[model samples]
Structures are given as C-alpha cells and as structure tokens.
Target: MFIEDIRNDFYNILLGNRVLLLVHYDVDAICACKILQGLFKCDNISYTLVPVGGISELKTAYEENNEEIKYVVLINCGGTIDLVDILQPDEEVVFFVLDSHKPTDICNVYSDGQVRLVYKDDEENIPNFDDIFRDEEDDENEESGSGREGLEALVERRRARKEWEERRHTLMFNYTQFSYYGKPSACVLIELSALASRLSQAALWAAAVAAEAHAALYVRSPARCLLDAEALHRYVAAARRHDDSTANRTACVVMEKDAWLPLYREWTLEAALSHAAMLAPKLKLYARSGSSRLRQLLADMGFPLQQARQAYRSMDVELRRSLLTALETAAPKHKLPVPTKATFILQRPHMSPLAALDAVYVIMALIEHETLPKAEGFQLALAALEVSGENEAWRKGSAAARRCLQAVASLVHATLSARKLLLAGPFSYFIVQDGTPEASVVRGPLWLGEAARWAAGGAARPLLASAATDPHTSILLGLPPRFEQEPRNLFGAAFEQAATKSGVTVSLDNVDTSVITLPTSQRAQFLDALTALLA
Candidate 1:
C-alpha cells in the first residue's frame, strides 16, 4: 500500500496506548519511519523506535516492555504474522506494511466485534466492527466478565482474544524484526519519536503544499515536537523524492491537457525540486482528474491560489496556470452558476473609471484581509503609502478636496467591511490602504511600489532589516514640467507645517521625506528654509 494507507492504519493503532515503532536502519525504512512520524505529529502521539536486527530483539522488547507498549508500528517489515500474534493478546498491534505486502490470510482478525480483513486500498480506512460484533444482548452484558461461567468464560475470553490477535498479522512472521511496546495492556499508546518526526514531516509537506500550485495544507498537531537535525534531514530527503516524482508526473499529466508547469528553467533543479517535493504527495491526489481536482482541493483547503501566485511571482508559471485551467475545467461540472452575490460584492455603487483605477492598492489590501496567511501584501502596501506621505495628505478634521477625501473614505470603508483593514484610531503607524481601482484613468495604486518593497522585506526576515517604526514628515512634490524653477520652498513650507503638527521630533537627517528622492538640486535654498521651519 501507499504512504497514506499506512499512515491511516498507524492512526488507528495510536487510538490505543504506549506505541512502539520498529524499522530497519536502511534509508527506505528510515524514510518510512520519518513519514510515519509526520502523521503522529499531527495527533500528538509518542513512540519509541527499535532498529531491526532480528525478531529476537523484537520479541525481547515485547516481552520485557509489553507493560509500556500500547501499540506496535512496524515499518519496512512486510506482514508480521507471528509478531502480531505474540503482541496481539497483550496489546493492540498496528504495522505499516511498507514496501511489501503480506498474504491475506495472516491479516484477517476481529476488531470492534466483527472480523475485518484489510486489502491494500482499504488499509487506511479502519472498519468499525463495533456494530458487527456487538449484538443487543452482548451490549447489555456490559460487565467485563459477566458473559460466562469460569470455565466457559475463560474459553470465550480465549476465543475472543485469539480472534483479536490476528488483526495485523501477515505471512512474514518470524523472519522480520517486529515492533512491540513493553506495556501493551494499558490505554497509554503513543510513540513520541513517531509523533515528532511526523509533525516535522507534515510541516515540510505543508510548505510544499503552499508552494505547489499555490495549494495550502493546514495541519493541526496535538503535540508540539521541535524537529531536530536528524528528523529534518530525513524529511528533506523523503520530501525531495516524493516531490520530484509527483511533480514530474503531474507536469506530464497537466501538459497533456495543455496545462503548463508552474516552474521554469530559471529555477534551479534543486530549488524546483524542493518546492515540488513539498507538494508531491498532494499533487498526485489532485492531478489525477486534471484541473478540476486541483481547483476543488484549493477551495476545500480555503487557499486562494491566484492571490498566492501573485504574491510569489515564480509561482505564476506552474501554479497559476495549472490552477486556472483546472478551475475552468471544473467550472462546468457544478451545473449551476455561483450566484454573483456569492462570487463578488455585486450591486455596489459604481465608481468612475478614474476612481476605480486609483483604488487598486486599497482593493488589494482588502483582498489580502479576506484571504488566508493574513495578507502580508496589504501590510507592505500600507507601509509604502504611509512612507510616501499620501496617507498624511488627509487630515482628521482639515478640509480637503471632496473627491480625494471620498476616495480614501470609500477605500477605508470597503477594507473595514471586508474584515481585512485594521484601523488603529486616527492613523497611528501603518495606515493600511484598501479598495480596488475601477478607473483606467486613475492607473494603479499610488502606494503599490512601496507596498511591494515592504512585502519583499517580509519574505527576507532576520537578514533583511525592517522599516522604521515612527511616522515621519511626508512631502508630495508635484513638480510641474518646465516650471521646476525649484519647488523646494513650497515643499519646505508643507514639511514645516505638517511636521510640527504631527509632533515628530526626529533629526531632519532621520526624516523619511528625503529617503525616496533628493529635492531638485536647485531647491537647496528651499531646503534650508524648510530646515529652519522644522527646527
């Protein structure tokens, strides 16, 4: 069976107590172990690992540690019929039969009351045998030992116990080293090693998911295990292999449908490999049905692939293209058109072309709020506007031109209503812009360039420095052509008036207005005048 099936089976065993993980020391087994660990991390289960030497060690481990072993997860070992039988009466046994499948006879067993036999595909879905096994009368016989007299009760117990012991047993019994926990009888089944490794793996998987076709996979793990070096190395290797194969396969499939891969030659094979590796597991899952599968996965995961691609330019090639195609293919299958109300904020007052054009930054900001990952894009755009002094152009009570004021007000209202823009009472530090541009004459958001820069900085954390925390004087130099005898005097006047009223006491050197550009060299006198006014 595949990794998913094994993972799901392990999950069921984890429902019991004190689990042990046994695997060969080989790379495949190691990868399998790491993969198993990734799943456990999601559930906060714990585990102990036993390196495979022979069944002697496993039997010893089981015999000595059965008291602590609640569940046994065997990896890289085919069907462990004998091991399963030995561990069965004492504890719940679960083996992720990786790279090998055991004969069917060894696998049949009674669980939750009914006899269950797991086939390859059905491995993941544990049969809820509770109903099949428990009759109404047996349900009433709730007392543990109430069903039989001593001899008869013992026989019934033996029979029931014997039936339960065969659950995970496969033909490869005595030869393969098996995993069994010491304390199997208790309800404490968890393997910490397995759980932690699984968590790290899942995190890696999530990153891959985010990178691949802009799919986002959110994992909530019950326990927190910091993936150390060994765990990470194992994860990286498995992720790379998984991603490469999946990507290659998906790329082939997508290309067949006239869909292009999101990545290109510009990306180093290693880099592309890394990105694809993360999404590999899910890629096959979504890639099977062409575009429709991909789109559905995106919607189910609550991920906005289009927005994510725009935010991460490199993704435009593979994720954006493939996703759009998939969405288009799947669109027809739903039969009914999504209501305009559902798809967009329809029937709002129409803005003039110019008005809409000017509102791009505002709209983008609002989009960021409505989407997941909390819109790092919006934050950057807002920062840029604040830096450009465009934000300060409007005052709380000062009379400004009605048109500009209304545009800004509308932007704010739209963003606020969308739950994306955070207003910190009369503009504190970052004045977030929201509203899309509807007017061609208005062009793109005036603050877009700056916002883009800020967003870039966020992607390069630790190494990249952050923007200033304080607000500075903003000067908008609307220098007219040929009339630039010098506008420094006017700029100085605005700066002087705005700076003091804004209560900024930074050095003229520290002021941000000069950061974007030097006022026309001819405006030196004006600069001095402005300097004097601020001082």
Candidate 2:
C-alpha cells in the first residue's frame, strides 16, 4: 500500500477531487498542512481541513467531512491505527496518509487498495504480507469436501493456520515494541513537490521547523535530525545564492553554528545560560551555589557582568560574535560539554533572525495555548510559520514560548528543591501539584517534556511526569532520560503494557503514545505496574 511515486500516485490522483484533510494537533502537522495547502492551491484542488486531536476526533472529522469526498489526506495521524476499520468509508474512498508516527499499523501496511500510505520509511522492516496473514482457504477446503482424506487435510490446515496466527502475534509485538517519529512529513512533501527543483524559502523554513520540532520533542533521534538537515542542504545552498538586494524583502534561511539553548537569541545571556538544558544541569542550578557557578563560568568566558546580564541584542557586537567560541573555550574547565551546533536561522532584511528551534517552540506553544480556541490557535500557528516583514504572529508566539519556558524552568527548580523527583524502579518521576503556578503550564505535553528533561539532572533513568488536570484525572507523559544518535522510546509501549497489568483504566488517547491520561486516585497503582513492567 506504500506509494512509490509521490506525484503520480499521490498528488496527481487528487488533482481535481474534493479532499478531506485531517491534520493532527502538533507543530509538525501544522507545518505540513500549510505546505500541502500551498500545493493544493497551486493545483486548484478543493479540500476541507479539520484539525483532529485523537482517534475518536479523527473518526468524527472524517465522517462529518467525508460526505462527498473520495480522496482523504491525513497529516501526522491515522497511520499507527487501523483507518479503514475505524472510519469505515465507502469502497470508492481512497485514503492517502502522510503520518510520521512510526511502527505503522500492520493492517494499514498491508491494507487493500482503499488505504494508501503516501510516504514509506526505509528504516521500517515491515514483515511480508504472507508472514502476517493467511487466507480462509482452510474453511473453503472443509466446505468443499467431507471425505476422510479431505477431513484429515482440513484438520492439518487448521493446525497450520493456528501456528501462523501465533507467529503473526509475535511478529506484530516485536514490530510495534516502540513508538517514534520518522522524517518530518513537511520535508517529504517539499522534496516530492519540488521534484528536484530549487528550494522555496517559505516551504523550506516550514520544513526546517517541522524537522526541529521532532528534535525539540525528542521524537526523532539526533542521527535522524542530521539526516533531516542533509535533506534540506540544497535549499540552504539556494537561499545562500539568492540576492537580497531587491526592493521587496524576502526571508532567507541560512545555517550557522549557534548555542543549543532554545530562544537564547531573544533572551538575556544570564537567563539563557541559567535555564538552558545543557548548562542548567551541569551548573547544578537547583543548588544554592548555582548562581555563583553561573557567574564564574561567564567570567571565565570573559563576558562582562553587565553584558552577561543584558539582553543578547544589547550585548557588545564583538562579545556577541565571539559568544560561541567563548563558550567552547571555557566549557571544558567548567565541566560543560560543547553547547554550540550548526543550526538554521531565518534572516530578513531588517528583522532579527529567528532560529528554527525557536520557531518550533513558538508554534508548539501557540497550538497548546490555554485560552485560545483550537481553531484560532491553529490559524495563529500557521501564521507564525510565515516569515513576513510584519511578523506579528511570530512575535506573539515568541512571547508565549518564552513564558512557557520560564514556567518549565521554574517547575524544574521547584520540583528539585522540594525533593519531589523520586526514582521508581526503572524510571524517575515527579508530579506537579494542582495549584502550583506552573501546573497549568506543564499540563501541555511540550512544556511538561521541557520540565522533565531539565529536571532529569543526570538523565539517569527514563523519566515519567504527571500534571493534575482535574481532581479525578491527571495527564502523564513518559520520556527517556537521555538519548544519543538513536532515540528509540520504550515509554509508549511501556505505558500500554503497564496499563494492561495495572488494573487501572488509563487513557492513551493522544496520537503520541508517550502521553496518557489516568485517574488521579489510581496513579500510584499505575506507577507500581509501570515499575513492575519496566523492572
């Protein structure tokens, strides 16, 4: 069911049809949706887009919008779950799914002509169809014969079918043992849409942010992130060659070595260093001496106290330019690893450059905005992705992102100070009390993840974090303590396995399996099961 030809088998097939586009509520999906919308506009393809949060919502959206639509395109969802069985669309309907969620449902992988996977990941070793399925020929043979010889053959066939079923179960469990993301869906669409053509800046930035979202969320491995960057090098090269001397200003994305700290460019030197994931743990920021250690490191880097305390933009030009080199030089003495990385920055004529990492944070924050309606937040997120002269959307999202990060840092400090982060067998965990200032902030998975990673001092074990959503229910998220080149998450599978044995009803309703919601009262029991499962 995997389509080899993106244009012919996927794009061309939807040229003149009315399509129902169901996009998941995530930064990557929003960026991918924006690119697909552009592609659809270019081809004059009629489509209705509905943002879905989970499986039930996806079904509802599809059923409501699929009245007259024969071609449906799903962004970032519906791949890991059985679509045809759940949606139950008419025979004429053909679904083209572009989900980055890995370990796609075997049913979807081998589905008949109705379900078509638009993108195929080379990393997935999907079992052969025959290995996982056997026809009902045994029943057919029994129906067609009754003689002793036929009866014996039928019994033999039944035994063979049972063995095949058992093998299939094992194969499926091994295949779906973990959940992770593949390449950004936006990157795939951009590549296939361009068809070896030069890269478009707007589309490229979207792709870059989408890729960074995977990294920022730890859903994609560092090695995979590098591969995502390699896929966009041509675009960066083209942007580098473009002339920005024209009257009309255009944004250009360029690669540069910068700090790994998110939103550092927009924050003051002291604040960025203090809250940064890499430096915070290394500096032991939760302890009383954390401040002196930070000042000492800055002093060692030769950054003046005044300059270090001021906004990054207000810092002296020479100091700003040499920041990376200074950090690299002083890092070894401070027991800090080199924190600089070659990353993308959006450059416009007179505007401050925006980091792709920052963009990911911005969009994610907007989408998870507490007060704003989801539809409005969705629009705001799309607008934020646009690198325009008057980037009001970007500014708004940036402000929200900053607040979110500050809350995460605050929560991490509070948790550590209160000695709430406790080890639970195979994982370490902390809970955000209901009325805490940052409890609302950490309720969203992205912010909670940020808090979790920061709180995981040495990242000694896989971390599980929970935030109270209500008196009866709480949301829990699991994360690996640390990952290197290959970040395979065992948490998703762990959550499900523990749920089965725990005898507690937990909801793994989110598209990302790492996140779940469970009864507040039964959380301790669920944790015990998880501990037992992981142990």
Candidate 3:
C-alpha cells in the first residue's frame, strides 16, 4: 500500500518536469525505472528512460541531455556528482535514491539551492540532534573506567568492557533487525543477532517482511540515522569495547568547511578517515552474516531464532550485511538477548488453551521446512491440546478445540506443500464421530460405518438412480440409520425406506452391508478413525 502511495507521489511530481530517469541495469534498479515510467504514463507526462552503462556513460548522458531535462530522477543510484553538476540550477531533480548517498559536496551544493532537489536519504529520518548524546551514562562509564580510576584498574575494566561490546556488536549486526523494530538501526541489529543463533536466513526474512508491512502502518517513525559527531564518537567508543577487534578496523572520513567550527580537536576528521580506510576491505567480509544482532533479539523474543535468521537472509544480501553491521556497533552489550520475536505474537504455551493452540500453530507456520518427522505432528498436536486445556471455550464446547484442529490441519497442509507431497485429487474431507459409553450400542466407532455408508453409498445413489419399477436400479445411502433391533430388521427397514423414497421396489436378498470397528487410543480416536475409514 505504501508502495502505491509512492507511485502516486511520483506521478503527481512528474506533471511539470521534463523527466529523464536514469537507473542501474540490475533488477531492483530496473524495476524502479519501470515504476517511474508507468507513473509518467498515468499522468500523461513526457519522459525518456536511460539505462546506466557505467559511471563514464552516465556522466556523458547527463552532459548531453542537460538543457531539455528539467529533472534527472535517479532511482537506486547514489554518489553521482558529475550528473548533479550538469543539471540546471532552477530545475527540480528528485533522486528516489537508495543504496548510498551523494558525495557530501554535491549534497552541500543542493542544500544551498543551486538546484531544487529531493533525495531519498533526506526523506528517511536522519538522526535527530536531540537523539545524539543520549548515552550519557556510557560516556560517564568510559570516562570513569578509563581516566579517573587507577591505571591498572582502568585498563582491566576497559578490556573487559571492550570484550563485552564486541560480542554484543557481533550478535546485533543481523539483517532481520534492519526491518524489524521499524528498521531502527539499533533494535534491528540487536534482534537480528539474537535470531541468527537460532534461525536460518530465509525464515527471518519471511517474518521481517511481514513485520515490516505491519510496522509501517502501526509504527510511524523510521529507524533513526546517526549524524552528530559527539554521538558518533560515543558510538565508536561503545563499539571499541566489543570483543571483535575488527570493530576497531573501520575508518570514518569527515570533510569540513574551515570557518564552520574552530578548536575542534576531540574527534578529528583525519582519525575518522583513517578508521574508514581500515574498514573498507573487511566491510565486505562483515557483509556475510554470522550471529547477527537482529537474530539475537528475535530469539530473545521467543521466535525460533533459526527461522527468523532464514527470513532475514532472503532479502537483498548487501542491505542485509550492511544493516547488520551498523546495528552491531551501535548498542551497549547486555548478557541477555532482549525484545523477543514471540513478543509480536500475543500468546504463549503457558497462557490460555486457545492461546497455547495459537502459539503452537504460529510456530508450526514459522518452521522453515519439513525437517520434522511425522512423529512431530503428534508432539505438536499434544502441545496444542495442552495449550487449549485451560481455554474456557474448549470447556464450554469443542469449538475452540475444533478451530485449533483446523489450524493444525492448515499447518499440516503448509508442511506438505513445503515438502512437495501434495496429491492431485478432488477436495479432501474427513468425518469424525464420537459418542458416550452409555450410547455404545449405536454410537462411537459404530457410527463411523454408518457415516461411510452415507458418504460412499447413499450420496452416490441419487446420482445413479433410474426410473421407478426399473429392476436394474440400485439404492445407496450416506449412512444407514442405527437400528437397535436385529440386523435383519435394520437391513429390512433401510430397504423399505429407499423403496418408499424413490417409488421403486428394492431388494436386499444378496446385497452386502459391512461393519468394521477401529482400534484407536482415546487421545487420537477422531483422527485415527478418519484415517481408517478413508483408507
């Protein structure tokens, strides 16, 4: 729905501009280009599409097409400066940008209004100045442990803190967290790492996408981006405390206008640049996930972290890798993983029976593949039953349990689907009959034979029957009514009823009426009975 909103916004913006959309050749970029083109068509706006061959070609195209193009809308391209320079000062150029940002100088020029522009990074909420330096306690601890304390004590404490930080960072740097927590940088990382320990990539991504759509509507704020120097410094210090010395391997590059601020010595742009250079190559390695922070958080939340991790991995790999790393280094380490995946679902095993059933159903639904054997089905069913035992609805009537049974059936269907075990046939239905001990003569397993007669016999009789007095006509019933008399009497009555209904004489001299009882435990009698009859 939000994507639709974005498409509409693009259409409205294209009305006045002579648009030239330049996009990369990759699938994501190409899709974005087509979307933009569709919008232009819908609005009856004129537009030309350009495929980016390379950086040089892009620059050449920008220069050649400069005057007539009022807006160069770049989708999924970032850090293009030459193209920016070629655009007219008054023209409105919007970059529905992703993947990266513009060269800082180009951004500065645009900010100064040399050209009217809108860029994606700006649309995404950048870190608020107010949000920076909120980690005062972290700063205080760093100062006290490293500077105010005795030298050996400080060194020991810092070393211990650093180890803790790295472990936290590694766990937090998970992709699932990127989209979870409304894609909050910190929360996403924390969650992803937690999940990674338990889930595979595909499962986490599945959940992340679902959560993303829901969170987009319910959660108003996008993840906060980091911008302030002081906040970044604290972030770095916190990161340094982590065990992974690789956290120390990154470099940050800062460019400045000399007159803007003076006497700034604490966090030099040179030091940041040095850090960024150190990290460039290793960043590629970090892109490959280990135990991510996002995974960890989901695990803590009680989502099967293994499945959550799988869902996370199903996304764009680069984004997954980058998001995890960003989140990993942002937060302080806690021994316990927090904010579980199960938190998203309201029920748990210990809750009401309905809740328990719900929890079991959700977990089964979340399973990545059909790795569990058929025996697991019984275990899951038992869990569902236990969960439902406390449900007042189940006590009042079997409605709650019946609903749960249907839910379990759905999960079984999904499992079969995943395994590619589906059979090609008409819709499959089941019939279950249960009766009290006092009604044993005409109830319980006895009713199953009658049900079979109704479904396999009586239902067929109507479609196959011929004219009255036709000797070749046959009689069928879905089920023969239970007669508490002699078997002969029961059979005779059934024949008489069929004859009266169809106005045909019916004969039962050589007709066969069979009955069979099934051996099934009380707990699974319904399911087993159905299986026996169907077989």
Best by TM-score: 2
Greater-TM-score candidate between 2 and 3:
2
What TM-score, over all chains together, does every model reach?
Answer: 0.24, 0.94, 0.23
Q: Write the residue-wise lDDT of candidate 3 on 127-243 in tens digits.
A: 323322134565467555344456777677678667766655554332111211122221222232232232222222222222322221121122232221123223323433541
Tens digit of lDDT per residue, candidate 2, span 73-106? 9999999888989988899999999999888988
Query: What C-alpha lDDT values do all the predictions have?
Result: 0.31, 0.84, 0.30
Ranking by TM-score: 2, 1, 3
Each prediction's total of clashing residue pairs, residues at least 3 apart in sequence or on different chains, is: 51, 0, 73
Model 1, 321-363: lDDT tens per residue? Answer: 4543543444355431211110001011232111111122232
Give me the runs in candidate 1 sitting further than 4 Å from their true place.
1-16, 78-80, 84-88, 91-101, 104-535
Instruction: Give me candidate 3's TM-score against the actual structure.
Output: 0.23
lDDT of model number 3: 0.30
lDDT of 3 at 127: 30
